[model samples]
Target: MTATSTTAPIRIGVMGAHSTGKTLLLQRIEMTLRGYGIPVNRTGQLGKRAALVPLPKMQHHTVASTEWVLAQGIADEIAAAARPGPEPIQVVLADRAAWDALAYWHAAQEWRQETPHRHDRERLLVLAATQAPKYHLLLATALDPDIPVDSRHAYDTRYRTLVDQHTHRLLAAEGIEHHRVTSDPDSQARAVDRAVKLCLKEAVV
Candidate 1:
């Protein structure tokens, strides 16, 4: 395949609910892509993925809840790992994204407004913002109740909406096109493959 000077490895991130086979899906993608000799890198395989679990120092902020923290860490690692544009297609699998909307909404009610934002907020946002242009695609893995599940908050539909909303906002703000995939792992993999084929084309001119 001919290469282009402006094109690079399309960075792909996979996100979804806990214990919903995200790891399995990630592995599947890596294996399938590798089989085709299409360079694919798993964050863990690189031994540098940042897991964004919340820290106890500042659990007070709802926006930086544990789940959100997990997402932030994953986002951070991907951002940090990303080299400037103009390279081959690279794929990074992050298990989660910023998902503290539920907690944030709950706290927004009682918590006093006008207070300075926490450190986590700035850092996490910076990570998302900076990586927006660096990534070619953002894949959101939906909660898969198929393989056993539990509603952290009664599986509240509201929370899911908020989660997707928060993610969309972040991606939009960063100027990146984000896509939400279904619970079916196969769909997720196929989507990535299709996106690569479509977006990673060689020089057009």
Candidate 2:
């Protein structure tokens, strides 16, 4: 594989609405890349980690929680990129990135008919937008209601659909290019592998 131009590791963020197989896609991509002998590191959901304060669900996301998740995500991405590796072609696969947090913030606001704290929301929005370019591949998981959402996680169909819509619009408005993956597992793996190879090839040029 051609080494990326920058010292920064290539970031691949998997994002979508709730229950869209984001986690599965992240895992499959990492596994597929490793099978090819490429070095890859993975990052999980930052918002779910024990935060300074407990974060509420998407329908109740607060400004503080949203900002924390976004900041933690950026910090985690930086650390992932800086991880020691023998080769310069390290890839970082993130299950969910800052963009997802921003999308959820909007989703939550709309769902609850409430807006986040103006100052913090604006600040985090700016930060997320700036850092988004670090992601060499932002793969959007296609909304697949065929896959059931665990009731324990979130069972709101409306909320999930709204989040998916918000995320799609944000990516487009920000001019961040992304590829949508189908629900089929095999198809997902193939699509992701193709995108990763193409991205790695482009990076070196």
Candidate 3:
């Protein structure tokens, strides 16, 4: 069923570099919200999905792939918000968000030293920014190189670092308000607490 204007799901988005705990953080928030009897829909793994489109990812990301990722993410969030069920969804946890694609695209361009088409970059940035106002809360993770990533997935450390840097840079440039999450336990706890409180508050409203 489509949600009414007053009952639209509150969206919480998390974006950052690979293996920087974006998924784990959202999982924690989702579990906690469910414990409180709040229904949440989370959109994730767009990177893997994009790759299936045979779209270039990581350092090979192109404007087309980046645009696809951003568009798909927006569509996912829209679907989550209007999900049909016995109990309407109260929260949408966007794992990568739209801006996350822009970060990877920017990093890829920098990594390959490719000259970006200014108009294309502008269009992508504008597309990403359109969703900024929809997010009730935005969280960005800071990369801690000291923490070892899962060996199962081969990740380029340099490109990962660049993504992290561009993620923050873009957030700051857009003046988007977001909580910065780190690898520290206390930091993680605080981020989780903030999300829980926000979701709980929204539920009551």
State TM-scores per candidate. 0.53, 0.84, 0.95
- Model 3, stretches more than 4 Å misplaced? 1-7
Query: In candidate 3, how many Å is residue 181 off?
Result: 0.1
For model 2, residues 90-144, the per-residue Cα lDDT tens digits are 7788778778888988888888887677887778789788766677777887787
* Candidate 3: tens digits of C-alpha lDDT, residues 103-147: 999999999988799999899999988887788888899999999
Off by over 4 Å in 1: 1-7, 44-91, 94-123, 144-147, 150-165, 168-176, 195-205
Q: Write the per-residue lDDT of candidate 1 for residues 1-205, one digit (tens) a residue.
A: 1112235444555554334455666677667666656555555321122123323212143543443454555555556347354544354444443332222332332333434356755664554454445445556555544444444634444444444454455444554456667766567767657655544352121
TM-score of predicted structure 1: 0.53
Model 1 residue pairs with clashes: 8-87, 8-88, 9-88, 9-89, 9-90, 10-89, 52-69, 52-70, 151-155
Q: Estimate every model's Cα lDDT from 0 to 1.
A: 0.47, 0.75, 0.89
Model 2 off-target regions past 4 Å?
1-8, 50-52, 85-89, 116-120, 184-187, 199-205
